[model samples]
Target: MTSTPGERERRTSERVIALLMLLIHTRHGYTTAQIRRHVEGYAELGDEAFEKAFQRDRALLEDIGVPLSLEQPEDADARHVVDASALLLPEIDFSGAERRALLHAREVWSETRLQTEVMRAVGLLVDPGSAGEADDGLGLPRVVQRLTPNLEVFLDAAVEQQVLAFGYRTAAGAVSPQDRPRRVRIWSALEIGGAWYAAGWDLDRQGERLFRVSRVIGRPEELPGTGSDAPARPADWNPVEIRDRLLGQGEGLRDRVRLWVAPGRGHSVRLRGQAVTPTAQDGAAPGEGWELWETDRPAHDGLVQLCGGLMGVVQPSAADPDVVAEVLAAWRRVAEVHDGAPPPHPELAKPRQSRYRQGQRERVSRLLDIVGLANRAGGITKVELADRLELSPKALDADLRDLQYCGLPERLFPGWLFDVDAESDVVEVRQAVDLPAPIRLSLPEAHRLSAALDTVAQMPHADDEVAPAAVTAAARIRQVLADVGHTGATTSVRPSTGGTDDPGDAAAVVPSAADGGGAGGHEPPATPVTSFWDVHADQDTVRVLMDAVARHRVVRLRYHALHSDRTTEREVEPVQLVQSGVVLYLQGHCRTAGAMRTFRVERISAVEPTGEIAKARRRPKKTMLTPVDTTLEAVLAWHHRIRDLADDYAPRLEAQDADGRRLTRLGLLSEDAAIALAGMHAGDVEVLEPAELRQAVRDRALAALRRLETAVRL
Candidate 1:
């Protein structure tokens, strides 16, 4: 593994966790022995390897930030069961904007340092959320295709731990530093700046270095793997420990360096006046004098500039004068980090593989301050800190050890003490870290067992294109159930409100996804199953036709009328897709229909021979069948509100059902028709037409009520 042992370990641990989540949800929960057996199958190695790997994995899951829980109920008490319900997977919530942000990150990583695992994670999170399942139907073929071109090449190179000879380029246009062919192991493929960069360990050079993806020349050729190159630290590792280790590596600057500030007309520097004590001369004349320090330098420019202006450094020999400029340049590059357009499906945007922030160092230091507020007064047990911080016993143990090393409290026994090192994994503390173990998970049935969870976890968010994602998800759930040949499992689609989930049983794990299902809480598992079949063609084709119609282009259609006996061909200019009752009716100047008539999609012969839009053709002016504000958004909101009220106004909903017993599609018309429809649905329906249309409906309702009163008196 030319890649850092840390990277592999982290990925392996994530894989283990992902697997465990799938298992727990599938088997409800498992015991320690069951977990060990099941985890061994997820891992490539044997029993010994699995046991060692599992112990480390268990500790990592319990760590702070990772956030997992363990429990032993009164019934499962003696079994040491792993309470998978406490996984807190549902606690992870991303806002619509945040969901959008995650998709944009895909473009950012389109090819950059954060490529492989980070990009994969992002894609995994987003695809399932939006567009039901990210597939060719979502029109993200380009994304997958683009990534595909180099995936196998990189994967092969990564696995081989061999030197990959290739040409390289940099954004700075820097050519290769080496004149001759250099042998090096490709450590990782990076996706930054919407471009790919393959960073590798230069055998000739011992330090870590970056490469620009665009500049790479020649086909990537991988050599054979080497034994020394595949050295391992551990197959399982804790991210918190890794972070702590990175911190402990050290910090300090020996020289006082001058830094030039950027061009900001009114930018002022803020200082932590209480923290840095000043000398007489340095304190008196800030810009003209320099302060000396024996510790690490402040990385933030505001602080650096404040420190510099308060105590100026004398321009000396050799230190880079462009240091400030360099930092500023990096800042400028990152300012647009979250600015890219979201992936077509917002769900594709997920949290990063790893995050790097300049201010994290300060945050880490502040952790010490926070700990002091609690422990310094009266020592807290590992369990207490664990509960407060929501850390697991193993994590609490590690935190305690780290605290102990910090000269806090000593000994595990309760006392009014706080002089123990946090780094110490005390035997007592480790033993005290009691947690529920895993339950029986069948590895052989992992995929089938996780169907519902996959659907829930990877659902889409409300966005443009198609109908409300909730409806689409409901439809997709039907597909999932259909695929599994289980029509008995009814589904109800509900909006995800970022709520806590039902605990313990896997079947109770019903999550509100970005989009797809039936009445909420049929089961609590995350359902992220992929829809292998294409469902978006109808909507997509309709969109294309609508675009052509708007642009006055002659479009070809390959329509498959689901209700019709067969598919058919047509060439027409679409005017509008009308909501005729509950079904979508296309109102176009159809060559076949021969008039400005509406054809229900369910009845239209398949739209065949769909090709390029003939934009030169002129479209006739017609009534706007749908609301001008009928954006993907307004439309979704309209439907979502209607669905929400259906439960409350079942009678009204039933009235519109056509079939009296079932509450099916509730139809909404253009503003003109909404009031008339409201009368049809009545108190069984409330005109939830966004207040813009409120008075119109209320007036009509009042008028109708008056008329009814007049008739009753007669």
Candidate 2:
């Protein structure tokens, strides 16, 4: 009797698992005859049928990321042995804090789609039975939210750098039910005020846009076609910068408004409010709980809308005749919005879109370029590939994993598809696919490069060789654009003021001041071109610290601590570099303090690598995308417009206040963090406690104002 297809599949799966177990647990090689005798399913099949099934099973295992290997028989006594790693799952080395954070996140997101993902990830890393038993006396001091299903899909696409098209619900069904669909390339996913938003490059608008996860009506499906047409992002594009810009949407000049939110609805609000209280106030409805909060922020419709229904203006008393009508009017407008009418400011109700992060896209493009170049070179080692891409080995491995599925659908059998063979010490690219020639230079790249070349050519006493070379390269790039039939005036090249007369000679085709080096013919040649590597610290010092971190070496640093108000020498085992906003911090183990510490790169006056491997290796080996400090905790408050900044600092949300203000416990690295918060927001930020930090902020503010006065005089 013939077996049903389902039966055959079940049997096949069982056989595959059995085969895997045999290979994984066996101490010695097993021949085909020996395997047939030992295994159940194979015993029922003839040699031909068994061989076909074995081949199919091997392919399935390989496809599933199983590191399977076959050792060939070389001599009479030797046999072909199937060799594989002992464990099917890769070991997870998350720190106690990270695991705890993940555990809490899983619990928080339990009912949502993100909960499953978090649980799965955590489950794979930790034993399910031991999940929440004990704590390590460490609080990551950050709120973790679940990813809506829509977000997970978009995030995956973003990681793959794939373009997506999806339906976005601009208005609630109670408002505008019509579906608004758009095509975009996902650049970032951020959580602000406990809501998730995705920012990306809008294909139709030829600009960047943001979408709220809750506003997204359905799962985003991958758009058809290669992402070749997507414009290249700028090399200096910073995601945090774009996120901050988006977060600042509709913000006005500072408005300090005291308010109270209903109990249980004040978490987002309290993260930025000073003197947050959770209790029913005098006029609160009986049995109704209230959270009182005060905050200073730029007044935007977003703030008013956030406070509506859930919170209300408490100070500038509602009973006061001077402001009673204004407060009543604001609440009335909010009431109208909830009643299915248009918001007083429709824009405030809509999600805020931000400019595409140019730097991240450039990094993705560079990754693709490096992979293509290395693959085309034939058999380039992984080390060489990493060196060429200027990426760490860990980073390079991640890129390769993402790029493995980057080709056109495998159904077409295109020879241009790429595959990575990462078995040996070297990474081998097999079945290489050629990259489709990029249609044109990214606008920012061309614009910036042109300005740099022009500046170099015009520099006083510039080296003849360098100046001429810059001019020649610029002209060639412009010529390529012109040859591609671009009709824009930016394609034009003019002669340099003192360039060679020969058309074929270097500097012969430098664009004149009028042409602006063939970059839109707009900006003057002297316009400054921003460098991607601009930083507050010495480049040499940063390089040294980065090397120490990578090599797991100790470094002696002359570091300035804002809390202590002094500079001192300390030996630190470099862990990793973290970027918060525009500042870079070196997180490591400090021998002086006998604990892990975070030191700002800018605060380090000098760094000398010890050249010895560090003994302290307790710090997590992986990089953190944001600031995380287990040592110091500061309870403070602020306005909501700066929510992105607060999240970047990884502050733990406590309670909500009226209109975009909330209380939070922020994890601090050093006094620099307080200074950073104070400086970034000026009077808006109130550093509460530790007395030292508060004084530091005051001193820094006074010093900043003094510097401003001095500059004004100069």
Candidate 3:
């Protein structure tokens, strides 16, 4: 495309203004060695080039319409840094006409920058005869290239709070979003994929706006615009704050948000909302009926838009409709675009989400205790629950205090306090409160958690703690339950009327505790049991193991095995440390095994670090109870086969839609030490290769069934 003489003149003027504005934006800033680093990259910069650049930039910026204020640097950090307070710009807001003009500009010249190269690429894709012209669809690439660079520069401008002037193009070839493109001061920008984007209050567009760099046709000027320039802000403006005002979207905004959703859309609503919070009519399971999201703020509008077709907003905040209209417009325009539309605007998306939480469980139970105990018996004493969870009197009080703040706006939800009734132990559940299916905590089950957490809760708080490993210990418990093949599992835990059985409270995995350096994250699979405690592990033991891992040391152990019903002493090399749930298990090579194995940390009678090794041995236990093919080659082959089989076997086969879910259960041999031959990933199984081992499991299951039937009397 050839530029008209008029367009050529306009282009030259825009570039000059851009360069000047660039210099002005950098005025208040100063740094050492800047000359060497920043001065070398441009087309033709000199020894005094940078010093000249800054001055020229300021002059050019003022020549436009931006009025920038900068204070002289103080002697202290003068040579190295610029003071922010001194350099400031006036407020800026785009008029409706200006925004519309800007949007028009964006539509037109957005691709003109790379027109030359872009056309060449298109020529390769489409024949002139077949396509009529090579440039038919080639313009998009040109626009796409320029937009990123301009957006990148603008993003930097936003972060730095510096003024910028660049040519903006509209759909009808107008330079401005309004009637004509004019030199303007851009105060800030937004960041995406390490690049900057500048979306602001467009005076021409009449609302918030987004500008893609691809549409910019001129260089950036750093100086504030002067007298005749229309871009300068009036004095007394906080550009940075203004930027936030535009980009903040709706933080902490509340509205009586009403969403009318279709029946099947309940799950969609929860997932889209990114939290299971159903803002329905005061109390009820989210999907049982029409879903309502009672938001304290303006976040509700986004949800309504997302659930569109299946949902619509009712009696929303005044801002809702406008925002909705904008979204729908964008959706309509981009929805069917498979040619890869630009990334969606971050300003439009909901803010990054916080982690999910489970607040209702303890709230209900504690509410039961509060109403049942306090109102009738002057608040149940710590001693009452002391024997139940095996908690100390002081710990019981701590637990109660924990339940107190659960669900108030301040705490954020039913406050966790006296919300429970102590007399009948009835919780003040709303009319919609559905009684939770009971949770069965067998003493044995509780004991496993108790033993696992027993060691962790007791560990001396380290100055700096690494990741927590309790989940691994918890996984062992879960695996056992899964093996039990239970579904819709519901059981009740009866409090002991007898005095406290001090298995010790092992509720460390409780949701109430969320620590940055605590029990969550990935763990490698378990090593075979070489020296693990066949018995139970206490909390103190869990902590010891964690310490061993962090410090990279070995411990002398006195381990008890339930299989042999005996105890043995040995020195084991601590290898990989694993934490599952509240229990800490060591998956290190053991001297006892002559290889690696899983050692329950709590069961170790004592831990004495003879020396510390920086690296832990990374393999499974060498010793085994049964004489199995133990060579590395054989182990590898077995591990490979099992994985292949697991892929096919994991999903059960059944006759009906629901028949196969539970009845067609498969259990692999995990207890035998030899079963550990499979690689670590098979924490679920130890058969080395899935392909062959699946057949072996069938053979074993049949044999076991036969044995069981024969034992039964007719």
Task: Please write out the lDDT profile of model 1 over residues 1-714, one tens digit for every residue.
Answer: 287864454345334433334343433445655554444243356778776766665554433123234556677632333444442212124444334434433321222222332332333233323423322122111121123234335433433334765554333233354554435554434321122334445554543344443345456656566424432212221122211121121134222343221221101111111123443322221122333232223222222222222111111111333543343332222222212321121111221232332132122222332243243323444443443333467645544544332221112123322245455332222211111221111111122222222222222222342223323333443454444343322142321111101111111011111111211212222221111111111344444444544445655554443212234566776655443112344666767666554455433424533554543433335433333332211111111112222321112122222111123223343553444333322222333324544445555444433332332233
Best by lDDT: 2
Query: Which candidate number would show the highest TM-score if scored against the true structure?
Result: 2
Off by over 4 Å in 1: 1-156, 159-162, 168-179, 190-201, 204-219, 224-268, 271-279, 283-714
Instruction: State the TM-score for model 2.
Output: 0.33
Model 1 / residue 178 / CA error / Å: 7.6
Each candidate's TM vs. the true structure? 0.22, 0.33, 0.23
Residues 554-595, candidate 3: write the lDDT tens digits. 777776542222456766666544433223456655677776
Please rank every candidate by lDDT, starting with the best. 2, 1, 3
TM-score of 3: 0.23
**Residue range with the least summed lDDT across 10 consecutive positions in model 3:** 526-535
